[model samples]
Target: MKDFLSLSIANLLNEYIFVYDFLDSYDLKLKDDELSKSFREFFDSLDEDKLEEKGLSIDLLKEQFVNFMNAMTADADTIEELESITIVGGVNKYGEPENVELTIRKGEVICIVGPTGSGKSRLLADIEWLAQKDTPTRRQILINGKVPDKKRRFSIDHKMVAQLSQNMNFVMDLTVEEFVRMHAESRLIENADEKVSAIIDEANKLAGEQFQANTPVTSLSGGQSRALMIADTAILSRSPIILIDEIENAGIDRKKALELLVKEEKIVLMATHDPILALMGDRRLVIKNGGISKIIEVSEEERQHLPYLQALDEKLVSLRNQIRNGEILNE
Candidate 1:
């Protein structure tokens, strides 16, 4: 289910001992009055010959144990084959119905554009809660063409969406290295040191200024903090759905930030007003009157203008850097 291939015997026995109840029917007892040992002790003391003598098949037991482990550890809240997230219908601010149906799938960047007070944030909220036609918007969200289970809607550990908001404040007083190390340890990632190093390197690339791992997370600049969080989320977070609010005003380099954030298998949805971020999406959702008025595919003509826009952006970045360096604006 959740990668039990590396699970130890101790871990397996501790996690799902109920699966071993079938052993009693085969005359192999862990709770013998003579031995009076724990299940783990019984397993460790018994050899392959002893197991065979007790009528237990080694290969068959191994296979059955793996199957049991898979079934036991699999999270019922998560959908393995999430082909698409469909939004059936929603309401506008005027209490009018939205007649649009949208599907967001894996490996696609969908941008949301709208004026102030439009339902852009509301739409994101609906997706985050996996709404079931219950909210004010009256929207129904579906996973793989079916309504998501109630467990996913309320479960804390099994979040489908990983949201990256505009503001990220580190309440903990740990250094950047310590912060990342904690996340790596929580994920039980192999080579945590290597992964932490890589995350720091990638974060520096996104930030306008580089930050040292020894620096306190609170000491980091706004751009550095955002960059670090983006890197951390990309590498460590297990949530398959990546949602982003407007990040254009943030001091981080938008291009590298997007690169570090987008995953091949993730469903990336962002709400942005910046032209560059808007055009970065494969398609843009046009929000009007507090509803998704239209969906616009990136025009081929606009695609051709990316290079020109990028060149201008680079120039602007250079100017911004000069300003940040206390240099006078040149005519």
Candidate 2:
């Protein structure tokens, strides 16, 4: 509170729009010269009788302003800072114990691999729900080694997990810049315009074809839409755990997208069938019959093959671009 009092009124209003709104609520206005003065100095100069008439004193105003700021920013302070997520053993379709205990840490990529309808999505759902042996799988999810409280598990305001499904579509009529700006503003981000620009830049880097900020969100193609959401989820979302269901078919730079998410120190759990993507993970969870069947660590031997796999992937991307351009395949 003392630190806040020392800040110039202009600085406070510029850095925290809430401060401006707080002053506006009380119909408080300052002269241009007063903007450079510290809020404490300005308040000290106010007429006591006038303040009393408004049912306010210097101490009361300061107290109420602090409380207002706290209420406005409470969600930002309470967002969970995850260290690791633990998945305790659960049962399979046959009611057999999965006999698995996996702990995934921040900045670690864990891949989920299995045939379609073999429970990959179920595992993601379990984590998303922060299951406490309640779901049919009987799996338990622990955050930072302890079971998350009901508030953290059920509160929609502060989610610990952000899931990215295979399909991404936008129905909004807003332009790309407007859409991203809306999300940034909702999060109460400082320098929102700068953040929005960075998000759009990163999204373009991931998309197959670049789109302008003026383009309507509904006008974006499938790949463009997926790229935008991936960028948004990576940059603006406070959720520490990211669940991606098969990004290989998104027609974007899948590896770069994962790298961006991991760079943000997020715990990434991707359900992917692409061998290159599975190999990219630090460990792979093999799901079968509605449960985790095995956990395979990415071996050094497998790590040695990524370069080759990446090269092949690049060739495919090149051929894809060539086809999109209507060029003949000479080779």
How well does each candidate superpose onto the true structure, as a TM-score? 0.73, 0.76
1-331, model 2: which lDDT tens digit per residue? 3367778888888878778767788888989999999878988898888999999998888778767766665555565567998999889889999998888999999988889999987888888889999999999999888888776776555576788886657768899999999899777777899989999999999997899999999988888888999999999998888888888555688888989999989999888878899888999999999999999999999899889988898888888778888998778
Model 2: CA > 4 A from native? 1-74, 78-80, 249-251
Q: Point out the worst 10-residue segment of candidate 2 by lDDT.
A: 71-80
Q: In candidate 2, which residue pairs get closer than 3 Å at backbone N, Cα or C atoms, i.e. clash?
A: none
lDDT on C-alpha atoms for all candidate structures:
0.76, 0.86
Total clashes in model 2, counting residue pairs 3 or more apart in sequence or in different chains: 0
Q: Give me candidate 2's TM-score against the actual structure.
A: 0.76
Winning candidate number (lDDT): 2
Candidate 1, 201-280: lDDT as tens digits: 98998888789999999999888888898888887777767888878545688877777666536777888877888788
Clash count, candidate 1? 0
